[model samples]
Target: MNVFILGLGNVGKALADTLRAQGHHVEGSTTTPAKVESLAQHVDKVHVLRGDESEKLAEASQSADVLVVCVAPDVKKTRTKEEREQHYQQVLEESCKSAANACQRVIFLSSFSVYGDGGEGQEPISESTPTANHDEPSSKYYQRAENHVLASSHGCVLRFPDMYGAPGDLSFSERVKMAIDYFGGNAIFGADAPLYAIHFEDVVASVVHAINEELSGIFNVCDDDNLPASNQQVFDAICAEHGWPALTFLNQIKAPNRKISAAKIYQSGYRVKHPDPNLQYLS
Candidate 1:
């Protein structure tokens, strides 16, 4: 199989490495030219281009059987609401457009932030759940991004929460420290909301499953087999352990408030390698 991955971040690089190890022809993209040599260790070919570079993407993905979009907004560049929305349009929405145009099969790595506190009821967030209707930039642009891919004949959208359990990713403690150092201990997520999350390996597996099964439509990809601790539970422990200020939630739930279900993907024969969120967290 010829696989082309956009945005060679932690997830994209992992996916590229996995696919390459499986004897597939893998091509990947990186915005930084300096990383091309490093990225070549994982992928057969590396294209240097931004996510919004449709022409370059189209050229690079010409022979690709699947185009997996793993582009993430640069957090350092997106501090304000306007900046975030614009960044999403470039990385998520525009990149999906380029992916759909370049490859017949499109798999998008999306965020559970699209669900945005979900509906009023206490039901678990499933594939059938209505997306966010509010103006939150991540939610709005991610929804738009999903639309572009789903418009194709064969498209898969795997929505995940904050992925952890990877050496390259920031630990829950580091995240709390970052919040304190940069954002004045304020958080966008609600304190009481359960932290719906997945392991880094499971995220890669889910994308591979989507490609192997030729899946279409939306699916919530997370560790649904085990219960999760709330933000308060995890953050409080991290703060106390580190002797840092506790994070203050804005009462805005960017993720699922109650529980998030991955039963749809499970029914499709995709099993999560790591299902316990409690084990994954530091707390």
Candidate 2:
């Protein structure tokens, strides 16, 4: 199989490496030219291009069986609404349009933020759950991105929560420390929102399963069985353990507070290797 991965960041890099190891002809892209040499060691080819570069994406994805769009928004650049809109337009919407145009099979890497607190209930979010119409940048643009891909018959959207268990991922404590020191406790997400997350390993597995089984439409790829610890619970424990001040939240409900069900993908025979978050108690 010929696979083209757009955005050679952590998730994209790991997916590319896994696909290559499985004997697929993998080609990936990175916006940073400086990272090309390092990324080249993992895939068959590397293209230095941004998501909005339609010509480059189409050219790079030539004869590719699948095009995985995994672009991430530049958080530093998205401080205002205008900045967020422009960044997401280029990163999510435009890239997805290019991917859909370039390949018949388009798999988008999306976030659970699309669900937006999952209403007022604790019901597990399924693929059928109506995506909340929040004004947040992530919720809005991610839905726009998902639409572009799902517009095609073979398009697939795999939605995940906050990702961890990867080589490049920061530990939960490190994230809290950064929030306290760097952002001055203005954490974008709500403190009390249940912190549902998925391992990077499961992320790779879900994408591979979608490609191999020709699965289409949306699937929530998360560890839904266990009770999720809220961000406040986790971060407060981390801060207390390290004798640091608690990180503050903007009280923004960016992601689904409700547990997200992966039963749809499981029914399709995709096993989540890391079902338990294992961080059962932070303190």
Candidate 3:
């Protein structure tokens, strides 16, 4: 099958690589010329697309069996709030239009952030859970994108959990560093807060399975473990793996409200390639 992946970010590139490795024709698009060359190393073709350009969007989306929208607004300090939101909304609209016109199946990369604070005791969030439009500026934009894709008849939305793994670029190491710097080598969260994550390899496998099966609908993609652990526990795991100092945990900190159940994807005969999140860091 021929697949076109829009937004050549970490996740998008991973998906393209996985598909190509499985003998599927894969094409990808990136906003940066440099990234285009990088992506070309993994897929058959790479198109440099300006996020605001409608023609590029149509061209990329119009000639594929499956279209995956993985473009996400940078949460880092690259653009102003309004600028970021406008760019994301425009990309969402353009991508959706292109996909609807050409692609038989569309897969959207969405975030569990749409679920917002899962509230106290919300152990494992399913596709049925009512989502909260997070108050955070970035999360709000993702929620809007999720809504746009799901409203389409041919779109499949994957509400991804916190994804982490190899390739360094997409790992949790940077996040660990940031937390340590901010909290003086300490991180905090409630003891019962459910923490969710998916390995990069597993993410790719799920996408491959969905495309091969032409699965449509919203599915929460996450690990089987829904048990909540403190930020300190996560930090310690990384620290121990990397031979660093363990961070302290503050009991007063509440866990972020986001956890997803991947049971639906599993029941669809999609097995995760990397079941253990901890093994991802070690590998």
For model 1, the superposed segments whose C-alpha errors exceed 4 Å read 275-283
| Model 1: colliding residue pairs | none
TM-score of 2: 0.93
Per-residue lDDT of candidate 2, residues 148-199 (tens digit): 8999989999988878888967877777777777777667888777887778
- What pairs collide in candidate 3? 118-257, 193-228
Give a tens-digit lDDT track for model 3, residues 1-283: 8888887777788887778888989888887787666677877888887545657666766768788877665534323546646665666555655555555577887777666656556466778776664544445666666665667666788877667774755456667776567657655334344456677777777877888887888887776554444344565678887777776655332334545577898899876565545445534
Using lDDT, give the best candidate's number. Answer: 1
- Scanning candidate 3 in windows of ten residues, the lowest lDDT window is 250-259
What is the overall TM-score of model 1 with all chains considered together? 0.94
TM-score of 3: 0.77
How far out, in Å, is residue 145 in model 3?
Answer: 0.9
Provide the clashing-pair count of each candidate structure.
0, 0, 2
Judged by whole-model lDDT over C-alpha atoms, candidate 1 comes out at 0.84
Task: Report the candidate with higher TM-score, 1 versus 2.
Answer: 1
For every candidate, C-alpha RMSD to the true structure in Å: 1.8, 1.8, 4.5
lDDT of each: 0.84, 0.83, 0.67
Q: Model 2 misses residue 225 by how many Å?
A: 1.8
